[model samples]
Target chain A: MPRFILTFTLLVVLSAGGCSPSNEQDKLTVVVAASAQFAFRDIAEEFSKNNNVAVDIITGSSGKLTTQILYGAPYDILVSANMHYVEVLENSEKTHGEPFVYGCGVPIVWTMNAEFDLDSIASYFCLPDVERIAIADPKNAPYGEVAVKYLKSLGIYEKVKGKLVFGESISQVNEYVLNKTVDVGITAKSIVASPKLKGKGFYRELGEDFYIDQGMALINTKTTHDLKTKFKAFVQSEEGVNILESYGYKLSK
Target chain B: MIDLSPIWLSLKLALLTSCLLLIIGLPIAYALSQWKSRLKVVVESFVSLPIILPPTVIGFYLLIMFSPENAFGKMLGDAGIQIPFTFTGILLASFIYSFPFMVQPIQKGIESVPDHYKNISYTLGKSKFETFMRIILPNIKRSVITGFVLTFAHTMGEFGVILMIGGNIPGETKVASLAIYSDIEALNYSAAHTYSIILLGISVVIIIALNMLNAKKRR
Candidate 1:
């Protein structure tokens, strides 16, 4: 049938064209969650320095990126904030192989007040002077969902409910804390670990067992590229773990 | 379950904001209409600033401005009056965001009236405020409605500034737009769909009404 021939020809053409590249082997596209942006940028930079491939990284909330992928966005790999999004792609047979757990994200109560330093997160909540708290919007941000769980587990979500504000992402929450627009906010440890924001605030890791597991998937597509596979392996390698740890991600066993 | 709370919150905000803008915008627009100076262009441009800038750009600065670290925010904080994450913050942000929508139409409305009508009223000994109430405002009723509708609709769809400055607390800062966004993020497409329909209905109704008024004016 023409339909079968059309599908076959399209697949062959797609495989023949490696990401609309200027050259066949030089282009790779990876979609990274907003939370993993800095780490992935560094990883991609290092990878391109050694390999001939030029990597392009697209970053946004994992859910939004997942929606884009489902709509046939030409990403070679997706690094999501949690496993749920990766599993969605896997269930649809859109992933080339099994997704791997790379890191565990830690949530923290961060503050910009110079004098209000504490080693624990609980006290930051009860400070009478601290009226406005910040967290990522819980619906799309895994860190926000984890933040909500951590607050509830601590038995303080209700009491602190009135004072809470929501950011669009972990990065915005970092801005709220660093600008002191909020008294304290729950944010990803990775944000504070970023070199630009490091030492700009006081943070106490929630260290609650409710960490969001980070996942990466090699998307199934007609494009011929091994760079995403290499980047994935590099992300799980010892050097990758070291780089992630420096950016405040807990190593996954 | 169908939650009407966010929709209700959005209406209440739009209602309150439009009312405030109507009360506050008239005098400001009036002053701008009659007053002319070398700095008038600067003032007019300042009023038009929100329309040109991206909402997030304004939202980001407003978030910082409302922070207690700044002088303005510090004063508010010292007064036990917090602006960030509050309805007041949303109202303030909405007022600034929707200011042009309110002012421009009214300014144009006031300008549309022929100067002879006001002069005729003045010749009969009508005061400035009296002339405005009797002569200018009567002719500009359509423009006033345009202002209110545009401001109301603009506030109803406000997302960026509210998301930046608001804490998204339920029944406080979480308006319908924010609710719909969070619903999409939660993968609750059905709820988001419902909210979008209602919002779409509102926008359709508003545009229809405005067109009707505009049509009447043309006649």
Candidate 2:
């Protein structure tokens, strides 16, 4: 019985190895900011189907992704939440060439609270019922940075600073927002508009003045495959723009 | 210069967690040591669950439980007792995550007291509380210290639970571990290095001190 089991395991392993080469050249690895995760997933899927290339999408805060790239993580492309991180990567000579604006993300005030006054976003923070407000960590998340800027512009940054909680990324902020752990959160519109979270909560756009210009760039590496270029082109293509638009992103082009 | 607040915050958290655990864990450990029921096994398992479970698991559940959307959380919220994103929240998290570290050692210490010493005290008309305080506690000095130090160090190194619930608020929840994480994420390598070295130094000193104490006890 043991010998038969061993033979069966050996046959299975051999068949798995026989079906696909260990190092497939047509595979592309794309790292994206957490806020753009859902939109990029669809873009990658469509690109994969059209080009017959496998695409792997990794999601993280733009700053974290840039740090990984700086440390030479094997990623083919980066879809940053803002232009700043892409510029940082470019300054560090981590990119193939100049980065391009892929989309512009609108920041939004999102809440699960039925009694939340969306119109009085500035005043809402001072309310007794609203105890905690979540935002992405401004240090690394562009959405968080913009949120802070928005508050500061309204001259209420200091007043509401005490109630703020910083999530590591926009995705973490979404977790707080959707779970209703926080009374409200400042996050990318793409997040609340994404199919999974759509209609689950109330979201008010923070206006075009608070938009973040999302950036994309190919990583410079010895393993840079043609599929990487094809993937980048596909993201800027009309189909990709439509997907981004559906997710509440405005096309820069 | 890198902010020294995170290091201080970590030390504060560790000190508070160990101190709080000492107060809470002593009675529980003592009770367990005297307990001989079949259910004791189940109780011990639950106490030790934090040690076995990943911090993220604890963090996730704690996050849910603290959210106002949950019934229990709403009750606390109504009472104006908020937990999420506050220093108090992280303190509670550290207490749970470091429960076994504080409990197990002291429990063993109590159990190691020969059955007769406790009986002798009881026979002499000493109350049960007095007997535990004077006889059992005095004998288990080593285990008590071990439990305290272990919990302190463990809480200092706590990351996942605090991350999920802490909200990375400066001067509140941004202890050394989370500070190091945020620094690395922001590509502030120098700040990250400074925090890492300090933590590494503190951790090594604690382990060495613990070993010396144990060695002296053995002697």
Best by TM-score: 2
- Residue-level lDDT of model 1, residues A43-101, one tens digit each, is 88887887767777656677766654654445688898999999999997889889989
What are the lDDT figures for the candidates, one per model? 0.79, 0.83
Question: How close to the true structure is residue B108 of candidate 1, measured as C-alpha lDDT?
Answer: 90
Cα miss at B98, model 1 (Å)? 0.5
Query: Which DockQ-derived CAPRI band holds candidate 1?
Result: incorrect
lDDT of 1 by residue, B128-210 (tens): 99998888888888888899889989999999888767745455677899888765543356899999999999999999999
In candidate 1, the second chain superimposes onto the true chain B with a TM-score of: 0.97
| Candidate 1 deviant stretches above 4 angstroms | A1-253
Candidate 2 TM-score, true structure as reference: 0.53
